[model samples]
Target: MSGQLEKIRGLKYIGVVELASQAARILAEIGTTQDRGTVSEMPDERTLRYYLAEGLLSPATEKQGTASVFGYLHLLQLLVVKKLQSEHLPIRKIKELVDGRTERELERLLGLDAKAGAKNEALSYLEKLLTSPSASSPRSQQFNSPAADMMRPVAPAHAARQSAPQQQGQATWARVEIEPGLELHVRGDYAPPTETKGVRRLTRLLLNALEGYRGNMRK
Candidate 1:
């Protein structure tokens, strides 16, 4: 029992060290104020400070000389904040959206890939945040609303199609029924059963419709 407990503690320590190493690497490569500003498109120094003050960004892990050194998590937060603001989402709302998440959890939510474009990934990440249960703000337009609840997934009608193969036709737009009425049509010749459109537009439509319908309900 003591051996098992010691092993668990050692593994936890190793995980923390691994995270610290990755954060350090991220900082060493692109942790400068100018670099962060350029990458995130948030050039104003005061704006970064405001985000820090508002608890939108986690504090630096360590300091180098005079300036504070930020980590990969901080970089991720900055990118997400910048992208949300470009969409005209309020700062307070953005803060509300990201609060109470661990660094690793936030990374998972953002779907952060070192190879992917930061802005595009951030935009993609925002959709997931809106749908997430953590978005508990009453002002949150989607998720938990009555109209949002009304839209449900349609189940398969039959168990299987045990019939002869049908003749193939010229490829047309690939369609995906995200909900009963909502769909995403992408112009492509993708093979059958392959994912045609991802959750991008489907997520947007659901969120927009929820907000739109909710406003109408109030009036």
Candidate 2:
């Protein structure tokens, strides 16, 4: 794994941090140490290669080495992809969903916060939070089912509403579609993500909240 990692780090790229070797080691450790949870197996080097080939993991940063180096964003992406895989999501589908999206976008899709800095700490934080007991809700479990069921495009506005936490004394006007037969009214000046960056951040917030909702549903 280390050798393969070293080789990849030798690739040329611009603006890449010089932490290629360290990033590779951290990734390897994560691969080896992740708990199975509901997942069958963790991804290995071969899997990483396939992801790289499929354009799922893009590491285009500057470094002094002969190869391109990866940065915190890349590390976060690897962690997200691995977690989704553990949910038994097929690589083909995962690739399809995330292929064109940037790491910043994927981070938002996974509902990660913007507090992303520090490669190792950020990666560890995401892994710990996503793999904790709360991550095992019915929604996450659904990822273990057939890929066809998990491929629906999420409705942003509705999803944003569904995943938000209700709080008292929040004054704003909001419209929410409850179901085919029912719609609800709320008073709050709630707005969904409209900007490119806002959309990603909103998506991440929704996903995290939705996971909690699913867990609650199972109780």
Winning candidate number (lDDT)? 2
Worst 10 residues of 2 by lDDT: 145-154
lDDT of each: 0.48, 0.51
lDDT of each residue in 1-219, candidate 2, tens digit only: 333433453443232233333444555564643464654344455655666767677645455467555655565566667656756788776765565466555555444434343464457657764554324355764433222122331244335445674543433333344322223343333344469999998778766875696569646
lDDT of 1 by residue, 32-53 (tens): 3243343444334666677777
Q: List candidate 1 stretches off by more than 4 Å.
A: 1-41, 108-219
Q: lDDT score, residue 51, model 2?
A: 64
- Decoy 1 TM-score against native: 0.32
Q: State how far residue 202 of model 2 sits from its true place (Å).
A: 34
Distance from true location, Cα of 72 in model 2, Å: 2.7
